[model samples]
Target: MRGRPAALLLAALLTTPAGAATLPSASILSGTCCPGTLWTPDSRSLLFLDGPPARASTGIYSVPAGGGAVTRRFSSVAFYSPDLRWAVRPGTGDATTLERLADGRRFTLPTRGADVVWSSSEARVAYARSDTTGNFDRRTTRVFVANVFGAPRQVATVYGGGPTAWLSEQTLLMSGKASASARDRTLFALNVQTGARTTLRSALGFRSVASSPDGKRVVYTVAFDSAARNGLWLQSTAGGAPRELNAFGSYRWRDARKLLLIPLQTDGGPHVLRQYDVGTGAWTTPGDLGDQVRQGDWNVSPDGTRLSYLSARDGNVRVLRLP
Candidate 1:
């Protein structure tokens, strides 16, 4: 009987999917120094905000992906451009400062403590100012865009949600309702120059609305909307029917076409890494972390070859090589 039980266990292990093998992962930063770490533009290092007791002063710090000594990269932290060319710093008042990292030259925008979303070139930005009082989903929001050192120009207005992501230098993706009392919200695109608008999807509300790296496609979640409308969906920026993704949980774009997901299976077990290829319309289990990700604090690398997450097991940032 004992021999039979051992043989059955071995068979079960052998029957497991090879692609879902446990990925190799290691802690890159420990001692509880990270919870909001972001990857560098080049994906070579991770950036985080830290201050006194842990260091000399408050600033942004960096650590190599392969693990190394921590170093300060910026004296102050703000919404930095992806190209690392400019820093958008919001003040206590209406004026937000925009500074070029290469030179000390700066300009100010009346953003009222809201951060501006930068274009890929880091030349132009879009931000919103909303009415202070009303229902959370009914507040009037006015959207504006401006060049690095130019006057602000109002472009669009939204009721509930506002500008979510910039699809291109001239285009942006956003969500809101047409009327204050409408239950359905819309995810749409706006042309900054021509003032053209294209509606993509409608639901009770949307969450985790993420644009692809190339800004060609978007993936978002619509939950508690309806049985048919609830789940993850993907759509083209040029406008098309929304394609529902079968799986759910936390996801990040591995590249322009590939999306990596960690299912919301909190069974005190390992977290599996599954991938969906938009071009091929296929789903494959890449691998699984031997532990759970802490607070969804995980992201795919810029090159789409690796992933990093704050470990729920040890409270540290860990790097994993994808299969």
Candidate 2:
């Protein structure tokens, strides 16, 4: 009888061994829902766009983190503000409508069908309009900013790039060539109120530029340019030498001080999660996904407690609690 109990315990251990470094169990949280899932700002639910063939009507639908009924959150879809306070509906032309969700108050900005880059407070927004008939890299781009329900005015003009982020209530991060003939792009911080510019870096090109949550630092990718500058770089928006992050892949800021990444590995193995600390300059491997992430679709939650990714093996959204 004692041997039988021991054998049962051994069998259990063989199936699920203790202290294993496997990924946290991920719950598939959707039906025939689809991909392109985004977390609600509260991080309580995942939202996806769906249409008549799969859902009752075309709208934004939400699924509970724990998996339950998928319900429509909005009857009509638009570029929603981060806090869900406004719906930005772009017309077929230059007119884009902004409807305040609370009071149904409405306004319009000539955003030319381009979505607005909102400030951290969601009170101010920035956007750009580019000339259509110029060289792709040297097109004249005009940047504009406005307050909620207010008028927009041109703030700056660059050869190609547009507003990257609102570094603060009054500051904007932007990049483009100094002139149409220049070979380098200048990534700089602009004070919209004071018209002061702080040059951050000049590079052949910048990709995936993201600002830290606190608006103090920025990280970006410089690829296919030159050997001396082709890497993932981090720099202060206040202007400083860029530091190249040793590891590269898809990266997102986990918080003010840590960045989460899944290294670009194509061996058909499960994607692994790694983290880097800006304060200590150390990297740590937390765990693996145990499944491939489809289309690089993964994001660390705003609260940094969880992560969500689309499963390559199942074509379903999966959620995992992060360590």
Candidate 3:
């Protein structure tokens, strides 16, 4: 439901509407259950890493979203891709292994124990390795991209920041300073294929950088910078003026055109889930969680119809259907 372009002038997206009620939620796991839980691509279950204290041994475990028996998902630990098709394990040395789950076929890359940034299709990936000794903002980071079972080619060199997201199979969004002494960082797009580049935005630093599912738009935060440049801003990947969102807190893209935000309110009230529809110029309160999120651990399901979070009140994982 894309509507007309939003007004883009509202000061703050109100999180609480009149007569707002608590959204219904159910705890799916208990006993100070797992951390690092992630939704399965099908969005029906949550996968988390647990050890002997919480489970039989240290491996990946799964629990249904609607609350049920926990099952062991993966017997071994590896950095599974977002699509759950590939498992990447960085070896003890300079090699990282990529294994296709379907066939158990594997290949290796010299990534120095660093994981990869996968493209949407999960067919290609990028990784970066930075200099261990130097000022953090000035350390050199060499970025590389590779196709599955192919050699990695050095693509972009950055100082401070690395690949934020892949805009397309060939276009990568990157951020870093042009030189070591530069005070600001440049958020730009790189055509990994033709070596072409486009400057997106330059700021002191970007926080919570996220791209829409289609990779056409981005939202990020710039804090402690000059007044004009500080706020949660939304901009296009194609390069244009950014619009500041008057609200602040953790945010997630709820599909291509909608965004879910949990406002950082500290008045001892339940955390409210407010959604901003980019195409409609309106904010809708989906209701509150009735409790705080533990360690700010929360996520929207892949299908955008449900949400899951570690409940601060009970120290368990909870799930709720979106209205």
Which candidate gets the maximum lDDT versus the true structure?
3
How far residue 171's Cα lies from its native spot in candidate 1, in Å, is 0.5
Quote the lDDT for 223 in model 3. 86
For all candidates, the clash counts are 0, 0, 0
Tens-place lDDT digits, model 3, residues 15-69:
3556778999998888886866899999999999988877878889999989898
lDDT per residue for candidate 2 within 1-323, as digits (tens), equals 22356556334322322233667755656453668788888888888889888877899989887678889999888889878888999997899998989899998999889869989888899999999897968898999999988999898989878888888999999999878898999999999998899999888899999888888999999877876787788898898789887556788888889888787765676777888888888877788888878888887777888888888888778898888
Mind sharing the TM-score for model 2?
Answer: 0.91
Of candidate 2, the 10-residue stretch with the lowest lDDT total is 11-20
RMSD of each: 6.4, 9.6, 4.4
lDDT of 1 by residue, 211-278 (tens): 99899999999888777787789999889898977566899999998999888764577888888999
**C-alpha lDDT values of all predictions:** 0.86, 0.83, 0.87
The superposed Cα distance between candidate 3 and the true structure at residue 279, in angstroms, equals 1.1
Stretches of model 1 off by over 4 angstroms after superposition: 1-19
Q: Can you list the residue pairs that collide in candidate 3? A: none
Best-fitting candidate, scored by TM-score: 3
Ranking by TM-score: 3, 1, 2
